[model samples]
Target chain A: MSTIRIAQLSCGTEYSGVQFEIESAARAVGAKIVYPDVSYSQVKEALDRFGFKPKSTQLQLMIARAMSLADRKFEADAVFITTCFRCAEAALVRNELRRFIQENTRLPVVTYSFTERLKAAQLLTRMEALVTIVTRKELLARERQSGITAGIDSGSSTTKAVIMENNKIIGKDWTPSGAVVVETAEQVLANAMKEAGVEMKDIEAMGTTGYGRFTVGKHFNCKLIQEELTVNSKGAVWLANRQRGEATIIDIGGMDNKAITVRDGIPDNFTMGGICAGASGRFLQMTANRLKIDIQDLGAMAVKGNWANAKMNSYCSVFGIQDLVTSLGEGKKFEDVAAAACHSVAEQVYEQQLQEIDVRHPIIEVGGTSLISGLVKAVGEVLGEEPIVPPHSQYIGAVGGALLSSGFL
Target chain B: MKVFIDPPNSMVLFDLVERFGHEPLSSMAVIQEKIDNIEVDMPPMNVTLDDVVRGLKYAGVEVPSGIRGRMSLWGPMIEAADAAIIIDNAPFSFGCVGCDRSNELTKYLIHRRGIPALTVKYPTDEAEAKIMVGQIKDFLGGLKQ
Candidate 1:
C-alpha cells in the first residue's frame, strides 16, 4: 500500500483554519497533503494563456494559482478542493479549477464545501470516501474494464439523458418535458441508449438529477440521486474543459434562471429566479411568438440589427410581452424589440441574482436558451464581457448527471 | 394606536400593521434615522461609550454592559408602543443581521412595557403561514374592539 498523496487547493485567506483540520483528516485517512506554491502573477499569466481575461476576484485568482501549480507536475494521487460554504465565488471558481486540473492532468479531483454547521466526523467520513475512490481509481487504471453508466436530468421543460462508457460520454439525447415527467425520462434514456447502440442491461450505474429527479429516479431505480446545482456544475466543467480559471454559469432554463458562479471548475455559489420568471426560456419563446418570428431566429435577428441601447425594463413575462407589443406599436424595428427583450432577461438575472455577489469573468451561459445567439449577446452586453457558450449547452445538465455516475464508478 | 414589532426591521410585520389600520413602531427605524442624521460618518446602529453610559442610567437595573447598551435602542420604542408582535425563528439569509442577543433584548423590553403582545414563531409551511396570519388578524381585531 503506497502513501496516497492528495493536493489540497483552496482560498488561503478563507480556509487557513480549515486547512489544519483537512491535514488532520487526511492523516487519519492515511493520506499526505500537498498545497499549491504558485503565486498570483503565475496564475494570472496562466489564465491569460488559456484565453481567460486577466482580471478576477480574490477567490478566482487563488483557484487560478492552484490550477497553474497543478499543471506543473505536482505528482499527487488525488486533488481536494475545499471552499467556504457562504463564499459563492469560491464555489464557482473551485468547479472551473477542478475541470482545468482534470483536463490538464490525470489527477482525480474531489471538492468539499466547508460550512460552520459541518461536523468534524462528517468531514472525516467524506475525506475517507474520497481517498478510497482515488485509491481505487489508481488500481483500476492498470486494467480498466469496460463499464457503461447513464444519467438523466428530468428538468421542468426538458428531459435529458447521457450514456458514458469507460469514463467518456458515448451518447446523449433530450426531449421536451411535456405533461408526464416519468415518461419523458424513460423516452430520453431510451433515445440515448439507442444512439449509443447499448442495451439497458449494459448500464452498470445510473443516476438522476434536476427538478423531477426523485420521481424519475424512483421510476428508473437509479443508484444515485443528486441536486441540479451539483450536477450542473460538474457538467459545465466536464463540457467546457478548455476554458481555464473561474467561469460563471448562467443557466436560463424554461421556467427558471439559475446564476451559478463556477470557481476552479466547481460550483461555489448559485442563485435562481422565481419559477416561471421572465428571465427564462419560456419568456423568450413567448416574446418570439409575439414578434411573429421563430425562437431560433430571434438571436440572429438581434445580432444583425442595430439596437445596442434598446432596453426592456419589465421583469414580468406578461408585462414584458406587453412592452414588446407597445414597442412594436411605437414603430420600433422587430429586431430591436427582440434584442431589448433578450437584454432585459439578462438584466433581470443580474438584478435578481448576480448583482449582490462578486461575479467573475468568462461567464459560461448554458441551457436551451443559451442556444439562442441573440440571448448570449444580450447577456454579454449586460455583464460588460463576452460570455462563453459551450457546445451543446442545452444538454450539459444531462452530461453532468452522467459524469457524476462515471466519476463514482 | 402604535404597535411595536420584534425582529424589528421586518417589512412583513410593518405592512401587516398598516393593513390592520395601526401605526407600526420599529426600533430599527429609529436607529436608522439616528444613524442617517449624524453629521459625521459612524457605524450604523452601534452603541457608543456615551450611549452605553446613558443606557445604564435609564435601564435602572444591574445587567451586563452590552445588554444595557442594546436595551437603550429598543427601550424607548417599546415604552411608546400600545401593542406588540414578537416573531420567533425568523428565517434570516446568509450575512443578514439577525443577532440573537438583539432579538432577545427587544423581546424582553417589549414584555417589560406591559402592553398586549402576541408571540409567534415564523411559519415553516403554508399551513403554519395561514395560522400565523390568522393569529395576527385575531390579535389586531381584538385590539380594535
Candidate 2:
C-alpha cells in the first residue's frame, strides 16, 4: 500500500522552525506531509473566493492550497492546518480553511497553533490520530466485538489485559506497572488467558493500546496497536452500553486525562492532556498517601466528607498538597480533605480539558481513577449528573483493543 | 536599510532598530505624516476612502475597514523592509496594534520577503529580557548593512 499523505496548510512553519518537528511526527507514523502545490492563477482565484485579499502572500498561498484540496486537485488522505500561535490573522485563516476543507472534501482534518519551541513529541499524537483516521476508518466503523480476541493495555501506572469472546469479557487481569513493559504485558496476558481457561492458540486475534502500545504490540505481534483516545472511548461506550448515541467518555489517567465525545460508537471529537498532574489520578494517589489510607478506601471516605469545608487549589498539585496539609493542620476532617482533593482534580479537568468538547448526557467515566468512588462522585458533582462507571472501566483500553481488533478477525 | 517592527507602533523596537544603525520604518512616523498632511483626509480620521481602496491591494473587502486602513499604512514598510523584528505575545500595553489581521499580514510579508527577520517572544521576566535583548543584538549585528 502507498503511504498516506497529509497535506500541510499553513503560514510561518519554516519561520518558526516547527516544520521539521511536523515532518518528524508524520514520519514516525509512516506517513508523509505534503504541501499541496498551487499556481499564481489559482492563488488569485482563491483570493476572490475569500472575498478579501490578505496582505500576506503566505496567507494567500494557504488559502490557495486549501482550495486545491477542496477541488480534489491534491491526493491527500488527511489535512493538517498549522500557524504560529501569535498570528491572529493566521488563526482566522486557519479556522476558515479548516471549515472549507471539511465542507468540500471527505478528508479528515486537524489544526494546531505552533510556537518556535514546538517539538516532535508534541505533534506525535496529533499526527498519529490523523494517520489512524486515514488507515482505520473501516475498523473504527465496526460496531461490535465478534470472535475471541485478547487485548493488553500498557499504561503508565498499570498494565491490564482482557479477553473478550462475542462481545463479552471472558477474563481480565491487571498489575502495577513493572520495569519491563513487554514482560508486564506478557504476564498480564498470560494470567488473563489462564483465567479464561483458554490457551494462546485459542485467541483468534490480539491487540494492544496505551503509552506502551507500540512496544507491547511489536513484541506480541498484535494485529492492532492503537492510541488510547479512540480505544478508551470504544471501551467506555461498549462497557456502558451507550454505543448507539451521543456520549462523552472521560478517562483521568495516572499521567494525563482524556475527554472524548462519541457519536454512534465512533469518536467525533476528543481532547487529551491535563497541563499538569494536579488534574490526573497521580494526585489522588498522593492524597491517599497523605491520608494514610489504601487508595481504594479514600474514595469511600471522600463521599462522606464535605468538599466545601476543605477547599484546595485546582491549578497546581503542590498548592493542592499544601492546602491538604494546611487543612489537616487546621484539624479539618480527613474525609473532607479527601473530598476536597477529588473535587479539585475534577474542577481542573472541567476547567482545562472538558471545555474543549460539548458535554452530552450519560457521561461515561473510565480508567483506574474511575474505580475510586469519591473521584467518580466528584466528576458527577462537577458535571451536575451521575456518571456511569461501567463494570471493567479500568480495563477500557484493553477492551477497546479487543473490540476493535475483533473486526480484523 | 529599512527595518520593519511588528506592533509597528512599538517605540521600544523603533528606538532599538535606530540605535542598531538601521532606519526604523515606524507606523507612528507614517501616521504622523498622514496626520500632518491635510490634502489626503480629514483630521482624526487620518486616511481617506482612497487609502482604504488602495488597501484592497493587501486585504479583502470582507475584512473590516480598520484592518484595511492599518494594512495600507504598514504594507509599504513591509514591501520596502531589508529586515524585520517581530515581538510575539506582546501585551496590549506594549503597543496596541488592535488589528490582528494586519499584524499577521505584516509578519507574513516580512517572512515571505526572504529578508533577515528576527522573531522573538515577549520576555516575561528580567532574565528572559536580557536573553531576548542579546538575541536581537546578535541578529542585528549579523545583518548586512
Candidate 3:
C-alpha cells in the first residue's frame, strides 16, 4: 500500500498530540502526516452556529468534509481520521468534518476526537499490558544486532515512549500525554531522538497504537495496526519478554485492565481483564496525589517495614480513603494498610481472572498500581509471589510498540 | 456599516462625557444593547464636525470625504461614518485625561454602527486590520491578471 496516510482535524489552533503521535508511530514504517483544514469562512460559519444544535451539527459535518475531498489525491491504502472534541473555536468546522467522515471513507473509519483516543489508549493498557509492540531499529546493523525498534505509545495519563538504538536504550522520555495525544507523543519522540542524537530519517518503521494512533497514523506513511489491543499486545510482549521472558502481562491503568500470556516467544493464551476502576494506573495516581505523596515513592514506601493497616476499603478511591483513615483511627500502620489495600486490589483482580482462565506465570504489573510496592507486595502475597516490576514497567506498552515496529517477533 | 472606536478610558473626552451628563457603563450598556438591536442615536455636543474630522486625522485615521468647518450635524456625520471606522480615543481627541463618560461613549460608538467595528485592543488586532488592508491590495492584484 502507498505510504500510510493519516489525517487529524483539530481546533485548528490548540496543541494536540495527533501530529506528534503520527511522527513517532510512523517513523519506522515510513509513514506520512497530513493535517487538513476546511475553507476558513466555512469553518468560521460552523463555529458561529455552534449554539444551535442542528445548525452546529450541519456546520460541523460540512466543515469536517470541507477540505477532505482532496483525500483522493493522496496515494493511501488506509486512512485514519481524528478531530478535536473541545474545539470551541473550530467547533462548527469539526462537526461538519465529523458528519463527512460518517458519510464517506471506508477505511475502517475510526472517528473520534483526540480526547477519545487518549481515553482508549488508557483503557487498552489498563485491560492488558500489551505484550507485543512493533519496533524498528535505527540502522541495519543496530536493527539486526540490537533489535532496536522505536514505539511511541501515547496514552492519556502519560506518554510512555522509548527508542532503542542497539537493544540498548539510546534514549527514553515520558511526559504528561497532552490532549493532543498524537502530536505530543510525536514531539516526545522527536525530543528523545534529539537527546539520543538519532536523525529522524534513521527511523525505519513506525507503529502507533491507542486512541491518538489514528490522528498520528495519518502522519505516518506505513505501520502495522488493527486496533488498540493488538498494538498494546505487541508493545507489552516486546517489553515483557525482555524482563520476565515468558510474559503474563497485566497492565492496569486509571480506567481498565488487561491480561495476556506470551509463551514460546509468542503471545499464546490471552484473556483481557474486566473493565474495573481498581485496575487502572491513573486511579492510583489520583489516589497518590490525594494522599499527598509522589507516586514514584509509593513502591519505596511499601518496602518500609512499619506497616499501617490501609484505610481504603470500598473499591471506590474516594470512599477507600475514609476506609483508610478509619483503619488508621483503629491504629494500623500506613505501610501495612497501604500494602493491605494493594492486597485487596490483587485479590479482586485474581478473583476476576479465576472466572476467565487458570492463573499463569510471570505476572508483570504495568500502570500506576504497579509502581506501588505496598500494593505490589500485597497482590504478590495473595498470588504467592512478588510480581516483577521492570524499569519503565509503566512503559511496557510503549516498549512492546517499538518491538512491534521492528518486526522482531 | 459605520463603526466608531472608543479610546481607552484615560483620555479627555471622558471628562467631556461627564460634563455632558451620562453614566459610563450605563452609556456603554445602552449603546451595546442598541447595537445588538441594530439602532443608533447620536448625542449633540459643542464639538464641531471639523473638530471631529481634524481630530480623526490627528489620531492617524484619514476619513473618507473629510468633514469641513465646525459642523455639528449628527445625522450626516453618522451617515459619513456609516461604512467607515471612527478611531476611538485618538491621541488628539481625548489626549491624556481620565474622562469616564466620553471614554465610554467612544467605545460605544463602534458598536453603535450596524456594521462590524472593532476596538484595537492588542497589537495583534491592529496587525490584523493592517493585514486586511494588505489582503485587499492583493485581491486588487488579480485585476492586473
lDDT, each prediction: 0.69, 0.83, 0.46
DockQ per candidate, 2 decimals:
0.01, 0.03, 0.01
Off by over 4 Å in 3: A1-148, A226-237, A240-246, A305-308, A328-332, B1-145
When candidate 3 is compared with the true two-chain complex, its DockQ is: 0.01
> Higher TM-score: candidate 2 or 3?
2
Q: What tens digits encode model 2's per-residue C-alpha lDDT throughout B1-145?
A: 7888888999888888888888998889888988876566566758876576456556544446777677788888889888889898899788867876677667756755778888899999999999888887888888888
How high is each candidate's TM-score?
0.49, 0.67, 0.45
| Candidate 1 segments whose C-alpha is farther than 4 A from its true place | A1-146, A242-245, A308-311, B1-145
Q: Candidate 2, after superposition: displacement of residue A220 in Å?
A: 2.2
The RMSD of every model to the true structure, in order and in angstroms, is 21.1, 15.7, 23.0
Per-residue CA lDDT of model 3 for A247-359, tens digit only, reads 56666655556555544334433444343565455545655564567777755665663333454546555666667667767877656655555555665565443222224
Which candidate ranks first by TM-score, i.e. highest? 2
Clashes of each: 24, 3, 106
- Candidates sorted on DockQ, descending: 2, 1, 3
Interface RMSD of each: 22.9, 12.4, 24.4
